[model samples]
Target: MGFLLVLGPLVTLHELGHYLVGRWCGVRADAFSIGFGKELFGITDKRGTRWKISALPLGGYVQFAGDMNPASQPSEEWLALPEQERAKTFQAQPLWQRALIVAAGPVTNLLIAIGILAAFNFAYGKLNIPPVIALVQEDSAAAKAGLDIGDRVIAVNGDPIESFDELRDIVVPNPGTDVDLTVEREGAQKEYSFTIPTLVEQDRFGNEFQVGRLGVGSSPGEIIAVGPVEAITLAFKQTGDIMVMMVQGVWQIITGRRPVDELGGPIKIAKYSGEQLSLGWRQFVSFAALISINLAFINLLPIPALDGGHLAFYAAEALRRKPASARSQEWAFRLGIAFVLSLMVFVTVNDVISLPIFGS
Candidate 1:
C-alpha cells in the first residue's frame, strides 16, 4: 500500500504532463495508462483516448496517436492515414511541439518535487547552524586533519562556508577525496588538507550505506523563517544539491569507490516507502519528493526507450534537419529495451540478496 500510495500519484502526474501538453499541441493521444501490461479496466473518452489502470503498477505512459507503443515510437499505420488525421498525429506535429510533449513528463516530476520542498521550507523554516567545531572524534578524519574543538570553519576548498550544512554538503558526496579546509583558530587562520573518510552505517531497518564523515560535532542549530521567494529559491538549491549527490553516487559506483550491490531497484523502493510511511506523514512526503526527483532524473537519461532518448533523437533531427532512418531507430529502440530489461533484472537480484532473509 505504501509503495502504491507513493508511486501511483507521482506516475499519474508524470503521464498527465505529457497528455496535456500533447493535447495542447493539437496531437491526439490514443491512451493514458497508469502501470503496464494488460489493462485491468478503462474507459475511452470522447476524444478516443483510453484512460485505464493496468496490471503492472511499476510505471506508466501516455500513448499518443501514431505511437507504435507506449514508449511513443512512431507507427507505420499513421503514415497511411487521411491528411487531416495525419496532421493530428504526434509524428506529424512540428518537431518543437513533439519535443515539448515528450519533455513534459519528467519536467512535471521535477516541478512537483520543487513545489513540495518549497511548501516544507515555507512551513518549517530553515535550519541554521554555525560552522564552529564543538567536538572532534578522537583519531577520526577531523582529528587527523588537525581540526580541534573551538576551531571555526571558514571555507571548504575555496568556497566560503557560512553554515555546518554547507560544509557537510561539500564533504559528504566526496568520500576519500582530499580537500583543503580553512579554519580560524584563536587569532590565526589555518589551512589543513586531508581526505574525508567513508563511514558505513545502517538505519533502523539495518539497510547499510556508506557516506563521507568528518567526525565532528556542532551545537544545535536554530530554524529561521524564510519568505516565500527565498523559500522557493532555497528549495531549488536543495534540489540541485540532491542532484549533485546522486551524480556523485553514480560516479562512485562506476569508479569502484562504491560497491555495485548498493544499486537498488523496486524492492528497495518499496522497503523505503514502507519504512518512511511507518515513521510519519512528513517523512513519507519527503521520501515521495526524493522519488519524484529520481523519476525525473532517470527519465532524462540520454538512453533510448525513455523520454530522454526521444529528446536525444529530436536533437539529432534538429541537427540533421530530418529524423534518423526508420531502420536505425527501430534497432536502437530494440537495444534500448534490452538494456533496460537487463538493468531491471540485475537490480532486482541485488535487492533480493540485500534482504534480511537472505543474510544481507
Candidate 2:
C-alpha cells in the first residue's frame, strides 16, 4: 500500500502527460492503461479510447493511434489506414509533434518534483547554515588537515560554499578522496589538503552505509522563510543539486568506488516507501519527490523503447531527413526490452539478498 501510494499517482500523471499532449497534437489514443499485462477491467470513453487498470501495478503507458504497443512503435497497419484515420495516427504527425508527445511523460515527472519541493519551501522555510567550523574532532580529518575552531570554510576544490549543507553535499559521497579546502582564519585565507576519512554508519533500521566524514562541527543552522518566487528558485537549485549527486553516485558505482549492491529495484522502492511512511507524512512525500526526479532521469536515458530512445530516433530522423529502417527500429526495441528485463531481475535478486532475513 505504501508503494502504491507513492508510485501509483506519479505513474498515472506520467502517462497522462503523454495522453494529453498526444491529443493536443491531433493524435488519437487507442488506450490509456495504469499497468501492463491482462486488463482487470476497463471503460471505453466517448472518444473511443479504452481506459483501464492492468494486472501489473509497477508502471503505466498511453497507447497512441498507430502505436503497436505501449512503447509507441509504429504499427504496420497504420500505413494501410484510410486517409482520415491516418491523419489522426501518431506516426503521421510532424517530427516535432512526435518528439513533444514522447518527451511529455518524463518532463511531467520533473515538474511534479519541482512543485512538491517548492511547496515545502514556501510552507516550512529553508535551512540557512553558514559554513563555519565550531569544533574539530581530535586526530580526525579536519585536525590532521590543520583546520581549527573558528575557521570559516570558504570553498571546496575552488567551488565557493555558502552553507554547511553544501559542504556535506560535495564531501559525503567522496570517501577516501583528497580534497582542497579553502578556509578563512584570523582574516587570512589559506588552503588545506586532506583525504576525507571513511566512516561506516547505520540507520535506525541497522542498514550499514559508508560516507566521507571531515570530523568538523558547525553551529545549529537557522531556518529562513522564503517568498513564493524565492521558494521556487531554491527548489530548482535543490533539484539540480540532487541530480548532480545522483550522477556522482552512478559514476562511483561504475568505477568500483561504490558497491554494486547499492543499485536497487522495485523491492527496494517498496521497502523505502514503507520506511519513509512510518517516519512521517512529510518524509514520505519528500521521498516521492525524489522518486519522481529519478523517474524523469531514467526515462531520459537514450535507450531504445524509452522516451529518450524515441527522442533519439527522432533526432536521427531529423539528421537523415528520414526515419530509420523499420527493421532496425524493431531490433533495437527488442534489445532494449531484453536489457530492461535482465536489469530488473538482477536488482530484484539484490534487493532480496540484502534484506535482514538474508543476513546481508
Candidate 3:
C-alpha cells in the first residue's frame, strides 16, 4: 500500500506533465488518466477531457485527440480537415512543440524530486556532519602519516571540507596517492599530509574494487536549520550528487567493478520498499525520490518502446524530412518489447538469487 501510494503520485505527476503541455500546445487531450485498462470511475471536465481512475495503478497516460488508431497514426478525416480543425491534432503540431510535449514528462519527475527535497529540507533542516576523525586503524596510512584520532579535517588539498561526504568524494578514487589534509586539533590548526592505501572492498552486489583509504572514520554532527533559498540550493545539489553516484555505479557495473546482480527487478524494489517503510517515512521518501530520479533517467535512454525511443524517431524524422516506414516502426517496437522482457527476466532471476525467497 505504501509503495503504491508513493508510486501513484510519481506516475500521476509524470503523466500530468504530458497532459498539461499537450493542452498548452493546443493539442486536445482526450483522456487524462491516472491508471491503465478499464476505468473504475471518471468525470468529463469542462474542457471535454475525460479524467479517469483505471484498474492498473502502476502507471498512467494522456491520450491525445486524433490518437484513436492503435498506431497513433493521423486519420484521413483529421488530414482532410481545415487548418483550424487540424490544429489540435498532435501530428499537425510543429516538431519542436511535439518534442516539448514529450520531454515534459521526465522534466516533471525531476521537478518533483527538487520540490520534495526542498520541502523536506525546509521542514527538517540540513544535518551537517563535520569531518572530525573518530578512528584510525593500526599501521594504516593515517597512522603511518602521524595523523591522530580527534583531528578535525578542515580541507583536502585546496578544497574546503564541509562534511565527511565531501572528504570521501575527494579521497576515494585516488588510492596510493599523497593528499594534503588541513586538520584542527585542540586550539591549533595544522596541515597533515598522507598517502591513501589501495584498499580492495566489495560492493553491495559482491564485486570488488580498489579504493583509497586512510583507515579513518568521521564523527556525526547535529542537524541545523536553513532558510528557504539555501534549502532549495541544497536540494538541487543533493539531486546532482545522486545523479553523479548513479552514473558512477553504472560505469562500475559496465567496467566489471560491480556485479550485474546489483541490477534489481520489481521483487527487489518491493523488498526494499517494505524495509524502508519499517524505517519510517523519511527513509521511504528518500528511497522514492531516488527511484523517481532513476525512472526519469532510464526513460531518457535511447531505447525503443520508451518516450526516448519516440523522441529518437522524431529526431530522425526531423533530420530526414520524412517519417520511418510503418513496417520499420512496428519491427522496432517488437524488438524493443522483446529486449525489455528479456531484461526483466534476467533481473528477476538476480533478485530471487539475492534474496532468501526460495529458502525453506
Error of 3 at 91 (Å): 2.1
Deviation from truth (RMSD, Å), model 3: 5.0
Local distance difference test, per candidate? 0.90, 0.90, 0.80
Residue 310, model 3: lDDT of 73
Candidate 3 off by > 4 Å = 38-41, 67-85, 139-161, 169-214, 312-334
Q: Report per-prediction Cα RMSD to one decimal.
A: 1.5, 1.5, 5.0
The residue-by-residue lDDT of candidate 1 on 1-360, one tens digit each, is: 789989999999999999999999998989999999999999999999999999999999888878765445566676678989888888888889989998999999989999999999999999999999999999998898789999999988888999999988888777888889999999899999898898888889888888889999998999999999999999999998888888888899999999999898999999999999999999999999999999998899888898898899999999999888877887888888899999999999999998889877
Each candidate's number of clashing pairs is 0, 0, 0
| Count of clashing pairs, candidate 2 | 0
User: Candidate 3, after superposition: displacement of residue 100 in Å?
Assistant: 1.8
TM-score of each: 0.96, 0.96, 0.77
Model 2, 110-138: lDDT tens digits are: 89999999999999999988999998999
Ten residues in sequence with the least summed lDDT for candidate 2: 69-78
The alpha-carbon deviation from the true structure for residue 83 of candidate 1, after best TM-score superposition, in angstroms, is 0.9
Model 3 lDDT, full chain set: 0.80
Cα lDDT tens digits for candidate 3, 1-360? 666757788888899988889889999888888877899999998878899999967578888887654334576767787888688878788888888888899888888888889989999998877798888989888888778988888889977877987888766865666899988889788887867677778744443556788888877778899899999999899888777777776776777765687788777777777777777889888888887887787677677766787788889989999888867876887787688779889998988887765551
lDDT of 2 at 11: 96
Worst 10 residues of 3 by lDDT: 202-211
Looking at model 1, how many pairs of residues clash?
0
